[model samples]
Target: MANRATGVPAPQLLFDGSEEKFDLWETRFLSCLHILKLKETILREPDEASDEDRWKNADCYAELVRLIDDKSLSLIRHEAADDGRKGLRILKEHYSGKSKPRIINMYTSLTKLRMADSETVTDYLLRAENIITALREAGETMSDGLIVAMTLSGLPDSFKPLAVHVTQNEDSVTFAGFKRRLRVYEESEKMKMTEPTTDNVMKTYTRQGGGHSKPHSNRKEEDANITCYKCGIKGHKARKCYKKVWCNYCKNNTHAESLCKKKGGQDGVRKVAEEQGGDQDHLFKAKYVKSDRPPGNVKMKGIMVDAGATSHIVNDINKFQSFDNSFQSETHSVELADGNKCSGIAQQRGTAVIHLLDNAGRQHTAQLRDTLYMPSYPHDIFSVASM
Candidate 1:
């Protein structure tokens, strides 16, 4: 007779359990096919649908059913759909009927499915076995090959020897044993690659000399103090003493003019000496000569004096034949100590050589030093010509 709900004659009852349980298995199988179909669709058209839509619309269970009918289950055995539903089916069939022998057979079939493709099947079986073990101990023991396959699946690619160890010793298959074997496998892999140790890492880091650890050194500190000649101080040298003295040339008590030997003047001189209680030999002599006109137009021939000079300069201006003939006129402005401006001409030809007459009337050439460009200079036109 036609069934009211399905609108077809009901098939003869084949199993003893309620139709609902069988319907559940059928629905689960269809759901797996739906998942596969959705996966293939997404792989082909990733942008077309969201992940949830693909899962909902997949037809993996239908594909599995077709695979079983055509005896092409081997073709799709390692596929995601088969792995999901087939493992569930085997477990359900094994536990559903009150048949211990049939349960063992079902387990054998499941193990065969696992061995067909070690990568996919081993992980699935491990999870299944863990669940099965938690619920009820596995009556059927695992074969050495299956255990090896399971172990190999858990280990990293470098530690394949762990799988071999498991295959060799199947009787002592415990979590602790697996961990020990994994450690051994890792050590052997490192030895094979000739990898270094923690000490080598520390040495490499330490040699860089910029790490958190202290630097390695064998040298010790030495003394750096010298005695000062003028003041007899121990912290500094005599060259750096800051005593002041009178300048006999400028008649200024601010500094001794003997040390003010710079030709142009002490317009940019940093420090000056003061009048301290000392003998004449200890004090510098003042030497100055005044003129009415600007020194740029005058001819100068005297010793090149560079005492406390920030820049090269010429003091005496009466030695050259004519200052205008020796130097081509280029407008150069200089700044004085009183913030006054003065004009000068740059020498374009040979150096403005100075022939100095010492106290003995002996002639000696004074060394021409380069002009100093102090910040006090109005413009940077105080450059000296190369001699």
Candidate 2:
């Protein structure tokens, strides 16, 4: 709007009594008055002003009435007609967030804002934007770097890496830049979860000195399509060719006599001793496989392949993809490898994420079902018996 007398443009910003817009409107209104050489009319009292100043004050009061909504105008309408300074003061008290209590409340809300578990980064940032805007409108001098810090402080541990990246560049980065980085990180995490995972290779061993044996069932029809290299058999691999191996105990060409089921008790012991060429102690055996990935920054301490364990167990609860806290029971207990037992009062069972190496020896994520929680256990145990 242009002034009819001075031909100067009046402040275009109108205040509709909105708390967030009051600060901007007031600033622009003051700037417009300064440009028109009428700021003294509102900033000075009537008694201290001259005839020209008084006339200018009246004009300024009229301009204020024109720039505000009915609700805001009503706040200063009853003031002295020429004393625009008093009217402006009345409006400032009502619309400006200068009150100590109001500013305190806004700061409190800002500090308490947190990102919920199911909330996306965009959603959380939007929610934070509202509070930050309110605080700034209240005359609080919150800097962009402080706002970024507050946003990162409210996020969960899953966003820790992203938070660190943003913090390191806080001096050079804008809040908008941090938000874009967060979105990219979130998308990458989602992609990692959806992609197919390879299963890890696990090898197990028996405590006793015995090798795998083939099943005894051998029908002629089953062997028709198969051939063995050792004995030219039609149904099995050379290692399982029973026709080529003689069993001294069974006294037959169908199988090895040492593997003969008829021989039991001391004979089995004698066969094992003969094969080893000496006596052997019956001891538990287990193999723990370390991930091929770089060990310096590995999250998991280690995974042990326990040939004797009856169930898979993990020490870290965060590794579980799905968990059942209700699986905990006081009656349950776990016996350690050292023959010590830990109470099951705090134990829980769930499906857990287990890192594994595929056939190609590449690291991949895999899930293990019915895994037991053993916080006191020294190492994560993958059970052959459980499999």
Candidate 3:
């Protein structure tokens, strides 16, 4: 079959100087070069290609060799570097390691594979897998059970219920079982976040008897729609109405909603007092409105708050401390204030808790329900509404 990439597929194994994956880097790099049929030329030196036909192949390899990074490039030095086999061996000898520091670093990362508050189990496992793979390559021995136990211990406290059950139950506690159960939990929780909720309108009672009153019923809401004859809303009598008496001018609580915005005045100046007319007569009831944009911020536990935003945004989804699998229903697009549009994009929603310390030194925690994880977002925008 033809290659999946219609045109050209970008290189995946270009070395970016991350020494931790040198073993992986070398294997993938060589394999990719070989697949392109350029490996023979790059790996074989001109001198080794004795004939005219061999020299042409060697020349092609030499040209592609420049695609390699500077660090590895230096290993292909003057005479010794000319030959592909010798150069590959030299690159391996220098870059590859049984080095104490590399192994120690890998072990340290494995030891600290924590499932952060914002991180999902799957992402945490992938991180752990990478660390475990590195350790294994370093000749470190780790049993599957021990690795599973480590993974379980790293999950957040919210997962404690399942974590405890898995650990305590002998029959359903294998690595595979844990992975399956964890994914199931993740799917269920995500569903709760995206599902439409009906309890938007809550009944409020007057001063003293609010808590003891019966909850609003669907029958009354459906029949009367709780048209507050007082506030023009349904469900409650005038005494129990909670709609605010608003002012259009001077924007203050002192204004009344019934007074005309252009006409409220002592000296022809509008000073809206709280509208007592809310109990006078019902004009028209306002229906609950759902906005097109998902209004709250998804809290990011470790991110600094950006208070000037209308909704939450992260620079990169991967930069998110934790991420769930793709959760948006449609391709979400964003239009900037400048009238530029970003179209057909994928966004993930994240949940996080933010900690705040008031001026008086009292600490409070706020939970963000759904944060937009936009990989192309240029900056973090923390929303006050979400906060």
Best by lDDT, which number? 2
Tell me, by TM-score, which candidate is best: 3
How does each model score on lDDT? 0.38, 0.63, 0.53
RMSD of each: 32.3, 17.7, 20.3
Cα TM-score of candidate 3: 0.41
lDDT (Cα, tens digit) per residue for candidate 3, span 1-387: 113777333455556556556667767766766776666665555554457645545543353354457866766766454455566666665655557887887777777778877777688877887787777766788876777788877777777756755664546355667688888988887886799753322222222244443433444433343343323444554334455554555343222344322343332211111231222121222111122326363332323233334456654444344555656526565543222345543367666444455557565664454567654332345556445
Estimated TM-score per prediction?
0.19, 0.37, 0.41
TM-score: the better of candidates 1 and 3: 3
Off by over 4 Å in 3: 1-13, 21-24, 38-65, 75-80, 90-96, 116-120, 172-177, 195-387
> Which parts of model 2 have CA positions greater than 4 angstroms off?
2-12, 34-47, 104-387
Estimate the lDDT of model 1.
0.38
